[model samples]
Target: EGFLHRWSSARLMGRRSPSQRKRDDCESSGEDFDEDDEDDTENEPDTRKRKGGARRPGGGRRCPCGPTGCQRLVNETGFRLPANPERRLAWLQCWYPPDSVPEKYLEKKQFRVHECHFPADAIELKEFKKSGQVVRSVKKDRLPDVPFAQIRPAATDQPRPARGERQTREAADATRSELDRIREWVQHGVETEDLPQGSMEVLTAALAQGQQERDKHLRTKERLERTEKRLSQILSERDERERALRAEVRAPQAGVRGMNALSYARFCTDRWLKKSMSQWLFFDAVEQLNAYALLLDGYYPLADITFVPRQRAKKTVPPADGERAEMRRARVNYPQNRKPALALTPRDALVFWLFVTRSGMTLSRAGALFHISRGTAASCYVTMTEYQLQILRREFPRLSAQQIRDAIPDRFRKFAKQQGVKSDIGHILDGFEKQFECPRDDEVRAACWSSYKHLYTVKFLLGMLSSGAHYFTSRGNPGSVTDPDQVETSGFLDLLDEGIDTMVDKGFLVQESIQKRGCICWMPPKMRQNQKEATAEEADDTASIARIRIFVEHAVLRIKEWGWFSSRQSLSIQQADLHSDVVFIIAMLSNWRAPLIA
Candidate 1:
């Protein structure tokens, strides 16, 4: 007891422990110790060593002295409090004497000390402890400064329940914590009662703001829920409509329009065909349709109905000179037993194909309209489309240079004269865009996105003669490609002959390319960067180009007039492979219309 008392007194007076004094003496005397010396030191008193036989520092462990017993050590040593509020209070309680410990700190639960650090500025700790002064009493009634806000714990701190349960618990916990904090702040403010004037007004304003924020959050949440409900309802309605339509398609029909020639002719009148011509026939006149059908029948195999004449039963007869008659012998050997059928006649099939092409309707709808199975309709449609496209491709017109010159009206010559150029424009060229569905592929999507159309599109170059006939249509390219790139790649330049002049829109920057091809390109002059407006000569040139180029646009309008191209539902991703063929067909058909220039 006496030795322990003397050691504690020495430590309080800033004197080194006996073990530390001996170690310093050994280090200063240049003495070398072996492993045995370290073993011997473990037996020494006041030697704070761990189980590994390593000596711990003096301040490494928590103080053995109770909170009230070591007040003098804390105040005299000038140690700063811990940064954490709870930790700081517990530390102070451990150091201060029972009478001197603050009353507010006494309410906190006891905290276990894990480790302690010596203050960096405690170099004079021994000097200050040696000349100890009277210790001051800690303020007993002062409140511990608690933060008004805290970050919510991370959700990843523990495994979460289901989504709904987690959300409900988090919201409840947040509300409770906020309310508790506000109540504590109010209590603290009341107890302190030392706030400056106008403090109550600030508190009231803060409370009102918090309330308003909570209400706003609630309103936003409600609005989101309602929007989700409405979207779900819309999806359900769409699904129901689809189901109903499918049921209607599966339903049997007693008799349908346009199933046979008689019904087709009766139901498809000029007025009715006119009303539906753009979507069904491309021609309003029945006579024109019949003529086209007859022309197609010559190429297409087999008629819809064939009348096999019945022969009267004749007695067996042999040819003279022992040579059997060929017709009589074949009739005796082969018998005609195939039955004639009447579901879709060649003319009606042509109309069906046109309807499918123009309307772009599903095969099922076309089959239902014609009182035939979907497979049969598809077969007929494919057959007719191939046959019709083959015939149309051959008939598509092209004007020679001489024909173009002869077709040019007087107005074009007047405009060319005004622009100081010869009135010998052979053809006009322009690019047209058709919107299509966005591609899912990253590279393909980027290629097809058009800044001009502000959509995913495919662009085609159309060439027209002075007479406004669509003489050529280049294959489709991605919309991102420029007009000149399409022109250079689409083989449109191949059609140009030396000395022939071509008119184009201002978008085409193909003057150099055309010059290389031994052809002259006439397009509007662009204003210089430094010049705001075009000069008088440039203005006349632009006006003349516009007048001549207007026909190309009219030709494009005729192509767009097809109901398939005019519909709101643009080209879909599935049709990407066939888009070139379809556009080419449409461009060719546009030439059948009356000449726009004449």
Candidate 2:
């Protein structure tokens, strides 16, 4: 009936379960009977009447045994009652008994009432409610303001267990493993464990190894330093011994005076007096004769001696029968005879010799010095130079007239042939020929020959100076000058001018000029010609002259260094030619002396 009533009420009000309504009615009626019994016997019967419809007579209220009620009773029997059930149960579905605790905690003997108890301040209300006393609301007290230093914060500073104390069974096993690794490092020079598992052991072994290596390195460095010091000491001692030995070796050779005497003697013997004295004397005589020839003749003699036949039949036949006798006579009257030798006197001979020896002498100066007329001096100087050249050929058998002819170039020989030039041998024999056509007066021809020979000498000398070639001589001082006459004559100057002209013609000289007179002369053709209005022909001519003249000048300066050419002496044409050959030989020697350039 309770279940029915509860279900009926639940259905009507949607509030009570069937079991809950039965339990509630039983409690209400039982409470009312108790109240009636205390009040009056008369009310007990009404309570009983009230319960009659739902309750059995003489039996307590029928037990409400629905599935939900039974289950609730079972759950309630398992639950513990709280000290203040009404209040505590309001927010709780279940409670724990005072003795209830985790089994593990209990087994470990760590469980205690104090471990689960609330704070002392929270127990008052709980106790009052459990005793059914009237509870009053109590205001919570405000916490005191605590200083930051006094407050216990989280355990940031807690000391960890020391290595010695961390000895739980598991930790002890790990420690034993670490010990074994250290022992392995000591015994085998390596760690048994990997880096991650035994980082500390690895680090310790590495440090120890590094320390040993450092000690060994330091010892090696000390040994090296000691070795270096010993080596340096030995080297210094050896150097000192060497110096002392050198000083001892040099001691006996230290007299300056003796050394100087030896040096001077060597200089005189080797350089100054190159050959035997006899050779020098012979050369001196030859040199003097050459000067004499230049003094008498205005020009030098022929370089090589030449010989002419003393007598020859005149080429004369009977005139053609038709030719008029008068015409023949007139033609014959034009001096049919040629003088073979030029007229040269004894004084003329001396002057000629002097002139050949000294290249040339001023006419006035010669006259004044020798006490003669200037014209006479000039005449003698010119005539005698040619005569001495002829005499030289006679005296020197090695030199021949044919050789002189051969020395001339083929072109010149051809020209001579075309001109029908005749060689005179005995022109000096006749007074009429000498008086009418004097050989002494032919200065120009003599000068030309003299100049030619001098040019050869200059060329040789120049080659020696420029190239450092050696000039050998039987007399031994090839560089020394013996015949001053060979050099002083204007022969070299004439040759230079001729060379320059030849060079200019060949387009080896260049020049600059605004006008004809303003032209720069003898410049190399390789350089540009700067003649403002020059014709190409004119520039080319000038350039040729410039090229040939430069070499000639260089040759002249080199020969001039020897005192022979520098002195004031006259030279005959013959002496000049001989000197030229000598100079040529020297130049050849010079050429041979130098090493061949790659």
Number of clashes recorded per candidate = 2, 69
Give per-residue CA lDDT, model 1, range 1-598, as digits (tens).
9999999997887676554566777889987645456656656676443442222355333322233232122222333334466656555544455467655344433322221222223223122476675442223232222211221232355565675663567755765665566567767765425543455445555678789999999999999999999999999999998986665455334253323322255436646655656557677566666777766666555373222224444555545533446655666442243343445666677777677667777778767665666666666765665666677677764556666678777777776687676647777898788888888899999999999979998898888776677777888899899998999999888877676678888789999998897777888999788998899989977876787677777788877766657777778776565666766777776666677886
The candidate that wins on TM-score is 1
Q: Give the local distance difference test score of model 1.
A: 0.65
Please identify model 1 stretches exceeding 4 Å from their true place. Answer: 1-244, 251-279, 298-343, 360-367, 372-379, 397-399
Error of 2 at 357 (Å): 8.0
- Model 2 TM-score (2 dp): 0.17
Model 2: worst 10 consecutive residues (lDDT sum): 426-435
lDDT of each: 0.65, 0.36
How well does each candidate superpose onto the true structure, as a TM-score? 0.51, 0.17
- lDDT tens string, model 2, 97-203? 33442233223221111101123343333236566775422123311112222332333564545568733676557766766767676687664454355657545
